[model samples]
Target: MLMLLWNVLKKFDLLSLDNEEEIISHLRRLSDDENYLLRDIIQAYQILQDCFQNITYQHLQLVKTVVEYSNVIEMMKKSDLYSTYGRRRFQELRDNLTTQFQLQE
Candidate 1:
């Protein structure tokens, strides 16, 4: 049950929320509804892999990679790494990461 709640929090992007009352309020708001989204973390991972082109998203190895690359993307956004060259490099890196995640047929 606790894991289920954790998955919901992660899926809803509410994990960073530290206010207990607010968290309870949100839980109450979602009570008995949208049960479809309350999945375990692995299922969420599979959903991510399915939605993307080639991301294999291995259960054992993905957490750090995602966190690190995601930070890079966020930082780059604030840094206006959106210049033509930077954007191209970022895309190339993105595509390369996709290839790295691809599953062999």
Candidate 2:
């Protein structure tokens, strides 16, 4: 279900390749949705991966906001989705973010 939504977003250039502000804004909107689901969180993680590919100060700030402001990570930890491919991808995002943050420090 969520994956389908991601594909649509991707088809429209709403995902990772879009502007950082746009992505962050979309994420913020998603986080605010009453029906926000695991797919939304997973999409955010995938966007983070995209942001990491072209690391910038703005992108870094977006990453920080997603990590610090959202419960996505904790949700991921609790979700059975973690047992699937999502888990590995989430871990990669986590590790990449940690490394990026450390290097910034």
Candidate 3:
């Protein structure tokens, strides 16, 4: 599932596509159990979301990168695995992204 999600995000150019097959293979080897897989996916999503939401403009390129990943963040909110807290955090991120885009305009 994480691989699927990553593939979708990669389509939007939010994540690197390099060695994708190898990454998926390693993720599969890391977890044969469904619960473990789900947990890892959720944790990874949360961490990435938080990172984008808390981004500072100390480096302009980093800010631009986070903005580019906003589409991936938006898609993540649609996942059934997204918890209530995750939904709230996503909303906050969405608002922040909107503000950033507006400022750019």
Best by lDDT: 2
Q: How much lDDT does each candidate structure score?
A: 0.52, 0.62, 0.57
Query: Can you give the TM-score per candidate against the true fold?
Result: 0.26, 0.29, 0.25
- TM-score: which candidate is best? 2
Inter-residue clash pairs, candidate 2: none
Candidate 1, 17-84: lDDT as tens digits = 45545544544445445564545435545433333334334732454344446667588788666698
Q: How far is 26's C-alpha from truth in model 2 (Å)?
A: 1.9
Query: Per-residue lDDT for 4-90 in model 2, tens only?
Result: 334334433445444756775766677567687788778777775664455667855665555454577567566645476778777
Q: Which consecutive 10 residues in model 2 have the weakest lDDT in total?
A: 1-10
Model 1 RMSD in Å is: 13.2
How well does model 1 score by local distance difference test? Answer: 0.52
lDDT of the structure predicted as candidate 2? 0.62
Sorted on lDDT, best first, the list reads: 2, 3, 1
Candidate 1 stretches with Cα past 4 Å from truth are 1-74, 77-80, 103-105
